[model samples]
Target: MKHIIERAQIYQALKAGIKKTGVVLPGDVKRALHQAIEKETGPAGKVLRFIAENLESAERENMPMCQDTGMVVAFVEMGDKVEIKDAFIDDIIHDAIADAYEEGYFRKSVVEDPLNGRKNTGNNLPAVIHHELKKGSDLKISLMLKGFGSENCSRLAMFKPTAGRDEVIESIAKIVVEAGGSPCPPTILGIGIGGTMDYAAKLSKKALIRELDDSHPDPYYAQLEDDILKRVNELGIGGGGLGGDITTLAVKVEKFPTHIAGLPVAVTVNCWADRKTIVELKGKDN
Candidate 1:
C-alpha cells in the first residue's frame, strides 16, 4: 500500500521541528552536560553549570539557546512507497525553514552569495538538505542547527591508505586541540572516515546528528571513538575553553567505502549546544 503525504503536512512538520530545535537542547546532550558537570571541578565545573542553567532558561522562556541560531541542515529519509502531493521536497523544506525562522524569531544567518553580494538571505532559505530513500513509507527528518563557531572548526584530511589507527587518532586529536576553545569546549565531534573527499565530509556532518549515547555498532569503531574522545579530554580544554577536565562530550564516527589508494577523513564539530531534532511523519494510510 502506497502512503501519501501532502505538502502542507511536510511544511508544518518541518517548521515545528526547526523551531523546537532552535530552542531546546537534545536530551542526550543535556544528560552529557550534567555528567560533565559532575566530573569537572573548580572553574570547569562552574562553566558547565552555567551552560546548563542557560539551557534551562532558554527552554523555560521559549527562546533560542544561542544567539547564532545556526544554518539549517536537514537529513531527509523518504520511503520508497511514499508519494508526495502539491510540492517539490526542496521547496517545501525551504518554505518551512523560512516560516520557522521568521515566526520563531531565530536569527537569519544565510548569505545570498558567497563573494560578490554577501547579502543576508534574511529568512535562512536554501538549507543544506541530504535525501535518502528507505524501504518504509514514513518520512524521517533530522534537523541540525549548525552554529558557525563549531562549523568553522571543521577539518578534513586525505591520509595515505597506509596510515595506521594510531596515526588517525593522533591526527583527529590534533585538530581538536588546535581548535582549542573556539568550537566551544566540551564539543561533540563527528568523524567520517573513508569515501571520497566530499562524501567523507558529508558523513562527518551526518555523524553529528546521532544521539551521543549511541555507540558505533562495530566494536572496532566504537573503541576508536572512545580512544579519540579520551585523547581530546586529556587536552584539558574544558567547558567554554576555560581549561577543565572534559574537553569533549562525545565522538561519533561514520564510515563509507573508499578507493584503495585513498583514506579520506573529515571532522565536523558541534558545540555543547548541539541543537538538533528529529521529525517522523507517517503516511496517511498508516
Candidate 2:
C-alpha cells in the first residue's frame, strides 16, 4: 500500500488543474486553434485571435481560466495490487475537495439539492467520482472540470439495432446546430457509442476527460471520430457561436460491448476551455 498524502492532496491538485482551464490551453489544442484562426477568412479569425491572447495572459498570471470553475469530475483507475493507506478513498477524496476549495479560494458552486433545498454545499463536497480497477501497479487519476454550459446541451439516444452510422451522424449534426454557441463554440465532443443507456452516458462523460487530440485505440473508431469532427465543424457555429468554417475542434468517442438488441449513443460536450490532467500515485500513497 502506498502512503501518499490524503485525498485532500488529490483534491487540491484537481482544483489547481481546473483553475487552468481556458488559460493554459494544451499545446496541441493551442496549435490547432492558432492554425484555424490563421486560415479563417472572416470574423471567426478575429475572435480566435482575441481568445489566444486571453489565454496567454491567463496562463501567465495563474488565474482561473474561466470565471466558472466548473463541477469536478474524477476518473480513477486503480491497480488491483495497489491499496490506499489509512483512508477510505471516498472520504479522502471529499476531504481533499474541501481542503482544496479552502486553499485555492475557488467559487463554491455546488448546492445541496437540485430544486427544493437549493442550498450551497459550501465546499463542493461529494464530487462526481468514478472508479475502475485495471491491470497496473500505479493509480491513475484524471480530472475534468465540466461546465454546465456545454454539458446542458448534450444528449443520449438509444436506437434499435437498425440505427446505422448515418442516423448517428444526423443526431450529432442536429445537436451541434441546435447548440448554436451556448456551450461556447469550437467544442470538443465526447461520444459514447455502445453499452446500456446509463453506461453509455457514463462513457460519454468519461470521454471528455481524454486529451482533445486523441482518438480511441481502434482504427475504425478513430475514423469515426474524424468523421464526426468533420461533420461538426461543417455546422458553421464558429468560435463563441460566430459564423465560421470551424465549429468543432475534435470528436472523441468511447464504446463498450452492449446487449445485442441495443445500440446506445450519448454525447457530452466540452467548451473551449477544456480543463483536465492526469496524475499517478506510487506504491503506498495512492
Best by TM-score: 1
Residues 183-242 of candidate 2 have per-residue lDDT tens digits of 887788889989899899989988877776666799999998999888888777788887
Worst 10 residues of 1 by lDDT: 41-50
User: How many angstroms is residue 222 displaced in model 2 relative to the true structure, after the best TM-score fit?
Assistant: 1.0
Q: List candidate 1 segments past 4 Å from native.
A: none
* Cα misplacement distance, residue 82 of candidate 2 (Å): 1.3
lDDT of 2: 0.77
TM for every model, in the order presented, reads 0.97, 0.91
Q: Cα RMSD (Å) per model?
A: 1.3, 2.5
Count of clashing residue pairs in every prediction: 0, 8
